[model samples]
Target: MEKKKLNHYDVAEVIDRFEINKVFDCFTLKNWLAIGTTNKLKPSHSEVLEEARQQLSIKWDEWNEEELKMNFVSMVIFVSQLDVPKHINTYFERKLSGKVNEISISVTVDCMLASPTYSGRPKNPYFFLQEFKRSLGDNHDPEGQMLAAMILSQKLNEDNEPLYGSWIQGRFWYFTTLTNKDYCVSKPFDATEPEDLLQIVYVLRKLKELILARVTP
Candidate 1:
C-alpha cells in the first residue's frame, strides 16, 4: 500500500495550539530559524548533527558508566507519564498475546534539524533514541542497551508498520552537538522537580507539534 503523505499545516496548527513556540524557545530553535532562513543551507545544522553523532558514536565505544546509569534512571522517570495511543495499545495487546507487559516504548528516529548537503540534498543530520526497559534495574551495559533497542525495532515492525523506514521509526533519537553545558547537564527527561518536569513536558509537547507540522501534511 502507498504511504500517506503527512499534513504539515495540520501539524503546524497542532504546534500553535500547544504553544510549541514557548517550549522550543528554551533550546536551539532560534539557531534553527537562523539556519533555515539562509538562502544557501549552511553547515550550521551539520555541525550540531555531527556533534550528536560523534558523542553517541564515541559513547558507544568508550562507554561512560555514569552516563549509562543516568540514562536508565532518566528513561524510567520520564516514560512513566507518557500516554500511548489506543491503536498502539491494541497492537501491543495482540502482539504480546495477553502478556501483562505494562511498559510501552517507541523511538524517535529522525534528526530535529536538517540541511542540504553540498550536492543540494538533505542527508541524515543526526538521530537519538530513548527506551523504556521492561524490568527496571541498576544494570549498565551500553552494548546491551543498543541490542535491546534493535530488538524493540523488530517487535514494533511486526506489530505495526512504521511511517518512515523501520530503523528511523524504531529509534527515538535526535542529534545535536551544541554541548551547551546547561542543556546537556540539565537532562530534560531526568527532571523530578515540579518546575523542571513542567518545562520538560512543555518542550516535548512543543516538539511533537513542530514535528507534526514539519512532517505531516
Candidate 2:
C-alpha cells in the first residue's frame, strides 16, 4: 500500500477528513499564548536576540527555507535553550510515519526536541518546529504539515498528552496545540517586533517545561 506523506496534507484536509476541530474557546487560546516575555530574558540572551532580529529585518523576504533556518530560525532555537545536551536534544529532517485510525501517515519533521535512547535516536517526541519560506498558499501547507506531524506523534506516543508544534515563515510564527480531537492556533507572533520575538523565545522555552513535566520515561 502506498503511504500518505504528512507534508502533503493541508489544514482543510486534516479537519474535513480526520474530524479535527479548529474552533477553540477564546480564553484557551489566550492561555496558550500567555507566556511572559517582558521580564524573562537575561542580558546574554538579549544580545543574541538583537543580532538575530537585525539579520531577520534585513533578509526575511529574500531567503529560502534553508537560509531562513540557518540564519534566523537557528538563533531563535538557540536562545530558547531547548534543554541541556545531556539526554534531550533536537533532531532535524527525521522521518516519522504510523497508522492513524487505519490510514497510513508519514512526515519529515523539520525540527523536534525529544529524549534520546542510548542508541542516539528520538525515543519520545516532544515538539515540532517547522520553517516555511512560502506564505500560506496552495504550493505549501504549514498547518497541514504541522497537524500531520502532531497526529503522527500522537499515534507513536500513545501517552494521552497534549502536543506542541509551530510553523514559521520569515517574521511570522504561529504556535499550535493539539489535545485530543481539539486543536488551537495562536495569532501570528511577528519576529520583527521585539516583544513578539521575546514571546517566541518564551514559548520555545515553555516547550522544555512541558516535556520535563510529562510522566513518561
Candidate 3:
C-alpha cells in the first residue's frame, strides 16, 4: 500500500468535517491565535509574540531579580499600547487637582534612538506603563512608575501654558533589551518595522472576527 498525498483540500476537508461550531467562540478564537502566535506556526511574525508569552508565563511568579531585568524589555514592549497617554492624563488631573487639559505627557530618555532631532525618530511616545510593571511582578508598584513617567514627560511654559512640540509631541516611550542570548533590540514609539505592524493588524483582525461572531447567532 502507498501513502496518500495530502493537499490543501485534504486539510480543509479535515477541518470542515469537524463540528467546529461547537468549539468556535471568542475565547476559543483568541486562544487559538495566541497558541498559533506562541507556537510560531506557519506565520513568522508571531514568533516574537509567542516567545514573549512563554517568557511571561514562566517568569510571572518566580520574581527573581535577574529575570526581572531580563524580562523588563519584553514587558515594556508588550504593554506599550495606544491608550496609555489618555489614562496617564486622567490620573494626573485627579491627583494634582488640576484640569485634564493642564496635563501633558512626554517621552524622555535622550538616546540617539529616542532623539527628537530627526524626523520619524521616536519622539514623545506613550506606553501602557502599568502593564509593563504587572509583567514583572504582581506586587509591582503601578502608581509609582506610571505617575512618575507622566509627570516627567510634561512641559512647563513661562506662563504655565502647556507647550507641546511634535518633536516632543505624542505620548511615547523607548526601550532596548536583550533577548535569547546575544541579541539586543530597541524599539521607539512608532519605531516598529512594517512587518511587526502587519502582525498587529493580523491579530486585531482576528480579534474583530471573534468579537463579531459573538454578536451573531
Candidate 4:
C-alpha cells in the first residue's frame, strides 16, 4: 500500500476547512496603533515608497505574483529592515499539525520572519506576509492566507505569545493576530498612502522588538 502524504490546500480552502469567519466586530485598529513605531521612516524610504506607489497604481494589473512580491512586498521588507541578517527568510514549506482535526497544515509563505540561529538554519517563524495577486476582485482572500499562516506560526511558537501576520492585495494591507486560538484581523491599510506605509514600518519594527525580547536574554 502507498503511504498517504500530508494534504495540500490553498489559503482559501484551508479557511473554509477551519470555518474561519470574517468577524470584523472582533477586530480593532485603535488598540493596534498603541504598539507604536519607534523606528521612524527615513527620507530615502519615503522617496522609494512614493515611486513604488505611483508605479503600482498604473501597472498593478499588468504585474504577476512575483512582480508584486519583488516590486511591492520586497520594498516593504527593505523599508522595514526585515532582511536575512536580523530575520532569516525560511520562506519554504512550514508544516504544522491541526488542533481540531487529524490533519496537517502547511504553506510556503511569500515571506517568513524569524530570529536568527547560530546554526544558520531557519527557525520558527513569528510573523508572515502574503501577497494576494488579484486586488481589484471582491473574491480575493488574502485574509484567509494570513490567518492560515498565523495559525501555523502560533503552533510553532514555543513562547506561546500571540503570533501575527499580514497580507497585501494590490495597494491594500491587512494584519492578523492569533492568541489562545482566538484570531482577530485588523482593518485594511493602504500601502499607497505614505502615512499608512509608515505605520507598517513601525509595526514591523515593533515585531522585531518582540522577537528580540523573546529570543534574547
Candidate 5:
C-alpha cells in the first residue's frame, strides 16, 4: 500500500485523538486574550500599519501566498517590530511527531517570527503566519494548517509555553493560541479595519516583548 499524504486536516484529526483538557470550560474567552500583555505597540506603530492597510486594500485579493506575505503581512510584522530578535523568511521544513498515529509529520510555514538562540538559529518561534487562498476554495484549510503548526511548536517548546499563530485568507486575519492541548481561536479581524489592524500589530509587539524577555540576557 502507498503511504498516505497527510494534510493539515489530518494533523488536526490526529490532535483530536489526544485526551487533552480544554480550558474554555474553566476560563472565559476574554480572559484568554488577556493571557499576556507584557508590552503593547506605541502610536508610532500605526504609521506602518496604515501603510500596510493601504497596500492591502487594493492588492490583497490579487496576490498569491508569497506576494501577499512579502508585500503586506511581512511588512506589517517588520513595522510592528516583531523581527527584532530574529529575521523572518521561509523554506524551512519542521518535522513533528503525532501522538495519534505515532507517525512523523512535516510542515513548512509561510512566515515564522522567532527568537534566535546563542548559535543564531530560530530557537523559540514567537509567532507564525500562514496564507490560505480563497481561490483554492474548499481544498484549502488554513485554520487547520495553522493549528497543526501550533501543535508542532507546542511539542518543540521545552517549557510547554502557549504558542501563537494566525492565518490569512483574502483580507481577513484569524488569530489562535494552543496551550496545554487546548486551542482557542479568535474571530476574524479584517485587515481593512484600522482598529483590527492595530490589534494585530499589538499582538505581534506583545509576542516580540515576550520572546525578548525569554531570550535576552
Candidate 6:
C-alpha cells in the first residue's frame, strides 16, 4: 500500500488530520503584520510595488496561474526582497515532506525561502507561498498545500518558533502562521490596492527579519 499524498487532501481534511484549529481575523497574524516596519519604503521598492499594483488592477481577473505568477506575484516578491546576507535565499517548485507519528504530508511548494547548503538544494525552509490564479476552475486547495509546507518546515527546523506561510487566490493574498496546533490566517490583502500591496511587502520583509534572527548567531 502507498502512503497518502498531501495534494489529494482538502483544507478541511488537512485540518482534521492534524488536529489543527483555525482562527479567522487571527490576533497572532494581526500582531505579526503590525510589528512589521514603520519606515517608508525605499524609492526603488516603492516603484516596484506601484508597478505590481497597476498591473494587478488591470490583469487581476485576466491572468492565468502562470501569468499571475510571472506578472503579478513576481512584482510583490521583488519588493519583499527575501534574499539575505546569511544565505537564506528563495527557492521555487521545491518538494517538502514530514511525518507526524503514523501520518505523513508531502507537498511541492511553489515558492519558499530556505537556507541552501549546496548550490540548488534548500536545506532549511522557513517561509512559503503557494498560489493559483483562481480557486473555482482550478479545483485545487492552495490553503491545504500551504499548510502542509508550513508543517514540514516547522518539523525540519525543530524550533519552537511559529512557522509562516501564505497562499494566493487570484489577486488576493492570505498570510498564515502555525504555532503548535493553532493555524491562523489573516484577512486577504488585495494586490490591486496600493495600501494592501504595501502591507504585503511589509509582512514579507518582517518574515525575513524573523528568519534571520533564528539562523543568525
- By lDDT, the best candidate is 6
Residue 95's lDDT within candidate 5 is 38
Tell me how many clashing residue pairs each candidate has.
19, 0, 7, 0, 0, 0
lDDT of 6 at 95: 81
Using all chains and alpha carbons, the TM-scores for the candidates as numbered come to 0.25, 0.89, 0.30, 0.76, 0.75, 0.90
**TM-score of candidate 4 against the unseen true structure:** 0.76
**Model 5 residue 140 distance off true place after TM-score fit, in angstroms:** 3.5
Q: Candidate 1: lDDT over CA atoms?
A: 0.28
Which one wins by TM-score: 5 or 6?
Answer: 6
RMSD of 5: 4.2
Pull out the clashing pairs in model 5: none
Candidate 5 lDDT (Cα, 0 to 1): 0.63
Query: Which 10 residues in a row give candidate 3 its minimum summed lDDT?
Result: 161-170
Candidate 6 structure lDDT:
0.80
Q: In terms of lDDT, which candidate is stronger, 5 or 6?
A: 6
Taking the tens digit of each residue's C-alpha lDDT, what string does model 2 give over 63-181? 88888888888888888888655557898888877878777777778898877878888877878887456366673677787788888788788888888889987689998888878
Best by TM-score: 6
TM-score between model 6 and native: 0.90
The better candidate by TM-score, 4 or 6, is 6
Worst 10 residues of 6 by lDDT: 131-140
lDDT for residue 13 in candidate 5, whole number 0-100:
62
Model 5: residues >4 Å from true position, as ranges?
A: 1-15, 18-45, 86-101, 132-139, 214-217
A best-first ranking of the candidates according to their lDDT comes to 6, 2, 4, 5, 3, 1
Q: Residue-wise lDDT of candidate 3 within 1-100, one digit each (tens)?
A: 5433212212122223321121222332234234244412334435654555456446555544335435533333333221222111111111211112
lDDT, candidate 5, at 15: 56
lDDT of 6 by residue, 2-72 (tens): 77555464778788877888876566577678853474789988987787788879888888888888887
| lDDT (CA) per prediction | 0.28, 0.78, 0.29, 0.65, 0.63, 0.80
